[model samples]
Target: MADISFAGQVAIVTGAGNGLGRDYALELARRGAKVVVNDLGGSGSGVGASATAAAAVVDEIRAAGGEAVANTSSVASREGGASVVNSALEAWGRVDILISNAGFLRNGRFEDLTDEQIDPILDVHLKAAFYVGQPAYRAMRANGYGRMLFTGSASAMFGHAWQTNYAAGKGAMLGLSNVIALEGSAYGIQSNVLLPTANSRLAAEMDQGFMEIPAFAQALQNADFSTSDGRVVPEFNTPLALYLVSKDCTATHGVYSSNSGRYARVRICAAEGWVAPRGATPPSIEDIASHFDQISELGDFSEPMTVYDEFTAVAKAARKQGVYP
Candidate 1:
């Protein structure tokens, strides 16, 4: 394969002060992208802000002979989102890619989770993507070229005991990305979700039991082993992110899991499921229970291309049963 480059392109990477976001900003800059490194420099719970975190990344990129600018704006609000993208516009004249990687964690069991805990997670993880992506997406649509990658998480897909709020927040990103993928395709804008397994501050704060699951635990430990020093560095996940948001990447409407040099696509598909004959009167509870096995069979699965596709399937089945007038 040829070398991938972002020459002449402009990108905005949120939460770039440190960890995965920092790595992504640096790599994009290294590949000739003019990057806007946006970070609020807050703790893992999304409190406080500072310029140091973003400025340091900007300095690192410049020192390495790459182009970058720092934007110390929170992505959780509409104004902050606009300001971040505005910074990119002022510096680069246009925006080509948006990597929404800003996030934080406030872990709590489902029962103990409060509205305060839930609201911030939703604001930062879910709503922030909307805020930032909206303006950038509009620009991309106008220019007829754009790439968007929203950071999701395995905790959302697979579930985590103490991260109910966080999982819900990340799950919203998946839905948001899917809609963007569908709507943006006509305009050359591709949107996808990233379920990254990096050793960021959020990972460090996770309950040990949450980390002990055999499948994920092994990956986490492997990342730990590869670090030269004892520090848990999130740079391990940058390469895949860089590729996903690059000009050469046209793959969209997809989800990917990246960590420890392992990358794979994740999909959301529904089973075809059993269908009752139309006009057959609603089935009894007993009848549904009896046909549960047929309804649950994975072999009957089909990937619906759109919301209408699902409805069309039902209509087709009804017509097939001679029930449509």
Candidate 2:
């Protein structure tokens, strides 16, 4: 296979000052993209800000003969999100790629999650996709080429305790990316979600409290997860993310996980469940209880692209079972 290149592409990476975002920005720049490194430089919990982190990344990129510019805009707000995109347009004239990776974690039990914890996370991880994506999407539509990567999380897909807010925010990325993929298809654009686990400040934050559960912690320990200068690091996620946002990517509306050097696709599939008989009366609670095991069976399944697709799958299954005869 030939080398994948981003030659002449203009890219925007949010939270590019550190962790996975920083790795993405640097690698994209190295691969010939003119990158906008936007970071509010806030702490792991989303408090405070500084411009230095972003500037330093930009400096590193330039020093390595790659092109980059720094933008210190908070992506959690409408104006701020647009400002990040505008910086790219103002500097490079177009945006061909976007990596919506800006986020922070506020860990808490579901019942104990606060307004302070919930609101900012949703603003940053979920709403920021809309704020930055719309404008960049428009540009890509006009240009007839674009790629988008939204950062999701394993916590949302699988399960994690004391991270309801974080999971909610990340889980929304799957829906957001899926719709964008369908909408952008006609315009030569594609969107995908990345559920990545790497050793970074973000992982460090998770270790502080989120990883305390023995089963969860033991699983990770057995996975041989390491930190700081270890093999399982942020740069491991960079390649997959860059690929998803590259012109060579043929997939859209896809969810993929990259964890500790393991890469795999994640899916949301529905089982071919029990269908009610064609009659005026709905099935009773007792009837449902009896057929619950059949309804829960996963041996036969369909991955639906939309709600209509889901219904279509059920219709076919019903026909096969003589319910639609």
Candidate 3:
């Protein structure tokens, strides 16, 4: 295959002021994409703003001989999201890729969460995806080709103390991406979410001791993080992020993960559930309890690519057990 190139494509990368988002914007720019570097320039906890951060990235890109523009907009608001994408359209005339990587950390225990603590998390992470992603999606559909990369978190899939709000917001992006993938399938537009485990500004600010766990701590201690310009930059997942949104990658309706250079696909699947005999009345509550183990078993689970595919898998499972023809 020929070398992957963004050549004439335009990309909008949110939260490009620093860390992972900055790396994504810079790399995309290096690969020939005309980039819109959007950063809220807020505090790590999701407060405050400045336009300088975004402009700094644009400067770096320009200094390296790449085309880029700065956009200082809050992804948490309707107008802000639209403005971010509009920056690219106004400058480049078309939008081909969107990297929704803007977000902030607000960690609070489950019981401690209240309207004040959770709203910002929901606004910036969940609602913000809808706000900005929709505009870009429309443009991509019109052009009949596009790729999107949303940021997700492993904490949501598993569990992380003091991060209830953050995790909830992150988890919600999967469903959003799934729908976009289904609808955009026919238009040559692909949407996928990334669950990256990296030492970005947000991840570095986490104080829950989760990283102190031997598995994570030892890895970081021993790992030789590949650097850029003499700095130990461990956004090693950036390369995978590039491939995921590239024209060469046709992946959609999928949640992929990368960390410390390790990569994998994350999925929600259904087990081959226990079935009652054909023509029998619905099983009793006691029957369900008796077969709980079989019903919940993951040993033979199947991963469905779309909602309709899940139904097909269910029907096949039923037929195998004589519950369907």
Candidate 4:
């Protein structure tokens, strides 16, 4: 296959100061994108800020003959998100790509999760994707072309104890991206989510050593599981993210996971559940309970991509089961 390039494309990457975001910004710049490296230069806990973090990345990009500008706006507020995008608009006049990757950890168990922990995370990781993407999306819609990507996490899709706040924030981005993919489709734009596990500060500090908590540890160990920390390397996670954010990406509304060298789609599907008979009285709790196994079985399921697809699946099932007759 020929090399994929972002030549002449104007892109924005949030939290580009370090870790996976830095890797993404540098690589995108290297591949010929005019990048806006947006970083508040905050700590892993999201408690402080500096301009040097973003400036340094921009410097590296320029040193390597790539184009980049620094933006130190936080991604937790609408104004902050727009300011970051404004840097791109101010420099290049258009935005062709967006990678919503800005975030910091605020870990806590469900019981301990507080408004203080929850609000900022939701603001940064979830709402901010919309804050930035909405403006960039409008630009793409006018230009009639765009590619948007979200930096999601495995912790949300799967589970890690003491990380409800972090997980909730990351999980919501997938929902946001899915809607963007649908809405952007008619405008020649695409959106996707990336659940990447890399050896970054966030990954290392995940769950606050929750794995050592024996009950959770024993339950998470699957019988078929055979893996090591080899997958935590960040370099291995960048390729898929880059591909999905490039112009050549034809796929949209996809949730993909990349750890080490393993790359795969993470799917959400509905089982072929029991359907109530036509004209039958509303099923009672006892009746529903009796069919619990059938309702939960994944022997046959549909991965609906849109709201319409859900109805289509139901119609198809009705026809197959002779319910329409």
Listed in order, each prediction's TM-score against the native is 0.89, 0.94, 0.90, 0.94
RMSD (CA, Å), each prediction: 3.9, 2.2, 3.7, 1.9
lDDT rank order:
2, 4, 3, 1
Model 1 C-alpha lDDT per residue in residues 1-325, reported as the tens digit of each score: 9999999999999999988898899889989999999999998888888999999999999999999999998899999999999998888789999999999998876777898899999999988998999999988898899999999998898766678899999998888998999999899999989888766677655666556457656666665455344333566567778788887788888889875566899877766566675566988888789979877777645566688888877666556546674
- Candidate 2 vs candidate 4: which has greater lDDT? 2
Residues 277-300 of candidate 4 have per-residue lDDT tens digits of: 666678889979998998888877
- Model 3 spans > 4 angstroms off: 209-234
Candidate number of the best lDDT: 2
TM-score of candidate 2 against the unseen true structure: 0.94
Poorest 10 consecutive residues by lDDT, candidate 1? 224-233
RMSD of 2: 2.2
In candidate 1, stretches whose alpha carbon ends up further than 4 angstroms from where it belongs are 208-233, 312-325
Please give, for residues 150-238, the per-residue lDDT of candidate 3 as tens digits. Answer: 89988887666678899999999899999999999999999999988765567655776545456656765786656333332436778
Q: How many backbone clashes does candidate 3 have?
A: 0
Writing each residue's lDDT as its tens digit, candidate 2 over 1-325 gives 9999999999999999998899999999999999999999999989999999999999999999999999999999899988999999999999999999999988876787789989999999999999999999999999999999999998999988788889999999999999999999999999999998876676545535647678977776786335434546798888899999998889899999987777899999999989988877899999899999999999789999987999899889999889887
Task: Give each model's whole-structure lDDT.
Answer: 0.85, 0.91, 0.86, 0.88
